[model samples]
Target: MQRLQAFKYELMPNGEQQRNMRRFAGACRFVFNKALALQKDRQAQGEKKLSYAAICKALVEWKQQAQTLWLNETPSQALQQSLKDLDRAYSNFFAKRAAFPRFKKKGQRNSFRYPQGCKIDQANSRLFLPKLGWLRYRNSREVLGEIKQITVSHHAGKWFVSIQTEREVAQPVPQGGIVGIDMGIARFATLSDGSFIAPANSFKRHQAGLRKAQQALSRKTKFSNNWKKAKARVQRLHARISNVRKDFLHQATTAISQNHAIVCIEDLKVRNMSKSAAGSAEQPGRNVRAKAGLNKAILDQSWFEFRRQLSYKLAWQGGHLIAVPPRNTSRTCPCCDHVSADNRRTQARFECVACGLDENADVVGAINVLRAGHARLACEVNAEVMASAAGTHRGDLAA
Candidate 1:
């Protein structure tokens, strides 16, 4: 089996390389914004949208133009890749997968990709990019597989590289037990086996410091050195919090995926769950503050990120992930199949009126999820069997 993986490392670029990297990122951002502007203008003028090839052809002319001749300093491929990214963004917008492409702002997620001419030196802990020469990086782990692409990005005043690689590996035989997970803000995850993964709440942990940093930033003069310093501090804090949350999710998901052959979870629509509940002035919404707090908690839990990590990890390990409908999972009784709003006596407890079975609400939800997943799997098997039998019957009739 073949699998794709990304390994990221912090780069220790010298002054010259750092300047070059900044320029390269700026060039890519400029190209993306220009292309987007051109597309929007064409749309307004009733002209056909420019394809990737057309954009690339225009980019060649753009570099040759007198005013934009500085673009020649950057890697040609990087500019082309930026156009490709813009095209993809437009495609995603048309397909309703994402919002329309927006102009890139300076000092915000600056990045450029090198699809070719990237070499990694494990012995020297160095990486080679197209225009940028050999740059040292902290090689925390061995880079596995063949490198397909390398992305250099600037975040929190630091430069980093993400190397995406593809490799062939033997698929492992399915092993370990089946389990169901109930995800919540109070607890990160509650398993059918009665075990729980604790929430990290990384943002909450640093909330006070972050608030202080933001206040200091607000007091600083705009475009001043102090303001820039304060902004960097805030960005660093945000990056730290994000790193903590990502690490927690990765660890939890890895453990769960490694231990379960068939993992069942709720099909949660996180975007819908976290929507703002504030209504218009004509019809004021109740519990506005409470809903805001709830939204924060829901986003802090990173339920969607957890599920995404679990999905890929499980696939890599030859395990299965099943998502069951979340409706009535907490109210339904696993032992008696009784489902009612009254069954959930409180947020933490469940007591089925029809069967007198009592359990923790999360644990009961996990049990119901497990049951639903089992039923779904069984139905699929039966359908497959019936289809095979029907095919055989049709063949017999033809004979």
Candidate 2:
């Protein structure tokens, strides 16, 4: 089997390299915003959206133009990749996987990618990109596999490089028993085995400090040295919060994936769950503040990211992930096949009406989820058997 991984390192670029990187990142941002604007204009005019080839030609024209010829200073592939990114954004929007594409803002997630013109000298802890000579980096760990591409990003007053690589390895035999998980606000995750993982609450933990830093930033004059310094402080705090949350999620997912041969989770629509309750002017919303806080807590959990990590990690671990319907998972009773909203009178408690079985609501949800997963697998197996009797090949019903 082949596995792909990304190894990140902090780049130690010289002043000239830093300036060039900033310029290149700015040029890519400009190209992305320009293409997005073009698409928007075409949409307004009821015309067809621009194709990648058309956008590339437009990029060439922009480089040839006197006013924006500075774009030529950046690597052409990077500029093309910017266009590709915009293209993908539009595709995602149309496919309903994401919101509509938006214009890029300067200094927000400043980054660039090199599809082929990148060289890595691991022995010397140096990397080379087109138009940027070899630069040293902090070698945290040895990167493995064949390098596929490189991405340069700036955040928290530091630049980092992400190297995506691929390699072949023997198929892994899955270990451990199957488990079902219930994700929630009160508890991060409750497993069918009666154990639960706690929420990191990274943003909540840093909320007070962040508020202070933001207040300090607001006191400084806009664009002044003091203001820039304050802004950097706030940025660093935000980065720290993100890093903490990511670290927590990684550890939690890794543990679960390594120990479970099959993991079942609800198919949560996080975007819908976290949507703002603020309605438009004429129509007001009730409990807007409460909904906003709930939204924040849900976002803080990073449920979608957790599911994504579990998916790939489980596959690589030779395990399976099953996403069952989320309806009534919390309200359904694990005993006596009872289901009722009254069964969950409180957030933490559950009591079945039929057989009077009582337990923690989350644990009950996890148990019901596991039972649902088993029922689903049973249906699939029954179909496979029926199909076989009908002289057809229906393989890997649980896959």
- lDDT (C-alpha) at residue 238 in model 2: 98
The models' CA-based lDDT, in order, is 0.94, 0.93
Query: Per-residue lDDT of 66-118 in model 1, one digit per residue for the tens?
Result: 99999999999899999999999999999999998999999888999999988
Every model's Cα RMSD, please?
Answer: 1.2, 3.4
TM-score, one value per model: 0.98, 0.93
Give one digit per residue, the lDDT tens place, for model 2 in 1-399.
999999999999999999999999999999999888988899999999999999999999999999999998999999999999999988998899999988888889999999997888889999889999898999999999999989999999999999999999899999998899999999999999999999999999999999999999999999999999999999999999999999999999999999999999999999899998899899988899999999999999999999999999999999999999999999887777777889989999998887898899999999888988888878888999897866643345433
Query: Candidate 2 — which residues are off by over 4 angstroms?
Result: 41-47, 280-282, 385-399
Q: Show model 1 residue runs off by greater than 4 Å.
A: 393-399
Residue 267 alpha-carbon offset, candidate 2, angstroms: 1.2
